[model samples]
Target: MNTPCDIPALQLSERSFGLLRSLFEKETGIHLRGEKRHLVIGRLQRRLEQRGLHDFESYCALLQQPHETQERQHLIDALTTHETYFFREPAHFQHLREQALPNLETRPLRIWSAASSSGEEAYSLAMTLADTLGPDGWEVFASDVSACSVWQAIQGLYPQQRLDNMPKGYLKRFCRRGQGVYTGQMLIHADLRARVNFFRHNLLADDNKLGEFAVVFLRNALIYFDATRRGQIIGKVVRHLRPGGYLYLGQSESFSEPLTSLEYLGGSIYRRPSCPAIARST
Candidate 1:
């Protein structure tokens, strides 16, 4: 179909907003309210033109085509914002380094960066774990709902400013400062990037054969969803964690329905009960 180049000031109609909302919810489980109408259209408009489409209506029709599955992927790329940086939450990293990693030495360690936005969080986990384990055989998998984020994570390159809050030791050890033509940017070492596998996944969707993980980081992302959906997503993730594994939530997020068979290990951390440690919650 012939499409027009993007019109920067293009207005989004109610019908267009509805189409964007449906696509977002289906792909990412993030329900965009009507208030975010402008945000969605503005961000995605340029991407439509990049794909050589002139208008949102044509993009919508493309998404509807059965063989245009790749178009839906592009829609996700355009719509989702991967605004993330290294060490985004310091306390979570501290806890992982001080408590979680030390406690996992006896077991085969596998961590899931469940809401790995832009790959920084997952790479951070891999760096911390690799530092602790030292070739002790551990794996980290980072997954995100955003197709663009997954691609960037795999690329392993980022702006230098993203490391503003990162510790000097970590900056030196895990990342190479951008130089020459690559000035003002940094890239994670291939060794570290090799340790993390980035893939597309929606938390609200069926669990793929993810196997089992020793720890699952389902932070920050839950804030976007309402309580009921959050609980459903949490329940699904916890099942893929092995017994005695850890589930970490965002500092501000809390569980309304306390998960059974998990011991509250203080703060927002919970540990799966090992064997007879279950205590019924009244």
Candidate 2:
């Protein structure tokens, strides 16, 4: 393993950066703008060093070879921003608890944490649903483009600090504090953990086998995509959103195009117009 100081400061050339950025967008739908040059360099430098490569050019070359699928995935995982916390955006959870959960008519209420990073948002959804809808009343499906993130979501172990923003009752009810050998960590209760299912999904791809959801939380992930791709992704996600279902975006994110099927419901929330009911012929 190479230490941070062991690798000399290296800058990604404009051509190399463009190459990598284009490749990343093509594979993952994440647009790395010119301003993110330094960020890309910082994230991928260690990967290059670990692979015993000298520069970004060589790294790009290696990625172009056939049967480098795993390598490409590793690159995507390295560049992914997994910044998230339990109930980070408090208002969204509050709305789900106060408004959405009560209105859902489905028997097994399903919620999708569409960009769940390291499980925080998904587990938060589980806690809220478990509290509001009871243990057997709901299911949370979490997906991420990063395999490593999906793996961590399945583990459901987190540092204690990550729970600071979570409600005290939820912390006590849905998770266990570590002791002695496992100090400073918390594990989500097995029952609550079991309620959430994690899977690897690329939003840019056509595999929408995850099924329709009553509420879809595609928060914070859309800011990385350009307008066209962002609209495309929202269209795909909306297809899996049931009629009258709620869709939540990060407070900072927005759709450039108007969606005829959805109506803005405030605080970065939108609702799909419910399909009209059919009348029975007597």
Candidate 3:
């Protein structure tokens, strides 16, 4: 299955690009094409240098060693994942404030930030929900595959720089500027922090039934998977959504074929058809 293009520029040998591609593909169902030869080398070359690996063969050997399990995860963490900011897609939050939350009558309204990289998306949700439902009525569940991101979310501290995308008034209201020894950081308000639960979870795998949620924000994460894998992952996550709940994808994504049950409300929003079974419970 190896192709000539998979070979690297400096190395005449087949190199470890095949092994790297296979590893990421297995873990995340993300395909690394043969043409990405330079990209593979460019991304991981620093890791090799840090570990004193002179060639791709040596890197592959290290990855195969059982003790290097955490190292492999570090590799995937670096190669994939994107930067997310508070209100990255501003319109979604606007819609939630003006439209969605007003209609829900359920107690303890649940929302899932399914790909909440580094907690901004989840915190935004918590802030809006707190504004709407107040202190006692709602909760946010935020999760990501990276252990590092989950830890950051739990700590609830961020560089003041990361709040650049946040609105000035909203920022002042929800965040506290670090002082003295803690300068240059912003700490999330304790109220918002308490409303969110952070955890490490891979969206490609089945998660334990935390609970059926009223809304799910899987945004921007599915673009990494191949089309077939995208369908499967979407289906699995949708199963956890309560009937009539909402699911939001990145604005760039649109479903076809089997996921047609969701009614598109434009701009990446979809509504799940209400189930008769849930109607009886209601």
Candidate 4:
């Protein structure tokens, strides 16, 4: 009997927000501050409506119940941000093409797009590697904390607007323009899609089943964490980098702690010392 407009907005009290924030940090390593209260509420309102929950307290209560792992994951999916586009921070790709690709002795160069949301960064890596190293000479492993995002990356589809920043020849070579019912979307060419494997991975977890990489792209994702959490994540992810390998961060982020094993390479890049002893000893 109640009209949509008649229902009041869900109220998230200070206690509820604190509890939710703590849980989110514990699970995802993303620190939500007091400032992000509105952002959190905005992102989670749909979950409330979907579950027919009346208030934030009830949603919090639901999350606390046992065997709500799927619900908790849904909460994470709702709260985590996945804003990304093709060839974001073009300088990183340029450096990879001109500097990193040529220096590696490894025949089949391995690269990891550590937080490859929606496949743009991963696809970009594939394009560059495919062009530089040829199809069989390179491989890409892309992973994200959000299963929804991992699935999206696997699909290799995107809206036309997302490709605005993509490099000039890539669209023609590595993508197919959708037509008919699928107009306004683009799909990464099947070959390129096959080259990049997508998976669901939590950076906070210690399980490193993906193995080592010559280049690891951990870009634009560290801004969400605090200094300590940032260090924790960086330290954990750096373990998977092969000796002498490169790690790329967003232009805006910098390491708060001195990692003696990694030499500062400038341009928001760091290189693990080429000496195997350094990596082994660390």
Among all candidates shown, the one with the greatest lDDT = 2
What are the runs in model 4 whose C-alpha is more than 4 Å off?
A: 1-8, 276-282
Residue-level lDDT of model 1, residues 1-282, one tens digit each, is 112544445566788779878977887777888888777767777777687987778777878889987778877776666666777778888888888777775455889999887898898888888777885588899998877788888998888877888778988998898799989999999888888989888888886599889899988888888778887898889888787788888778775776665778767888876564574441
Between which residue pairs do clashes occur in model 4? none
Shift of residue 216 alpha carbon in model 4, Å: 0.4
In every candidate, how many clashes are there?
A: 1, 0, 0, 0
lDDT of 1 at 208: 59
lDDT of 3 at 117: 80
What lDDT tens digits, residue by residue, belong to model 4 across residues 1-282?
222555555678999999899888877899888988878877788788999988899989999998998888887777888988888899999999998887888857889998887889999999988887777878899999888899989999899988999877989999999999879999999888998999888887886577889999999888888888788888888899988799999998865666657877788888888885654221
Provide the overall lDDT of each model, using Cα atoms, as 2-decimal numbers: 0.80, 0.87, 0.80, 0.85
Residue pairs with backbone atoms closer than 3 Å in model 3 (clashes)? none
- Using TM-score as the measure, what is the rank order of every candidate, best first? 4, 2, 1, 3
Mind giving the per-residue lDDT tens digits that candidate 3 earns over 94-147?
A: 888887777666878999999888899999898888777777888899988777
Ten contiguous residues with the weakest lDDT in model 2 = 273-282
The residue-by-residue lDDT of candidate 2 on 79-184, one tens digit each, is 8899999997899999999988778888788899999989999999999888887778688999999988999889988999878999999999999988898699
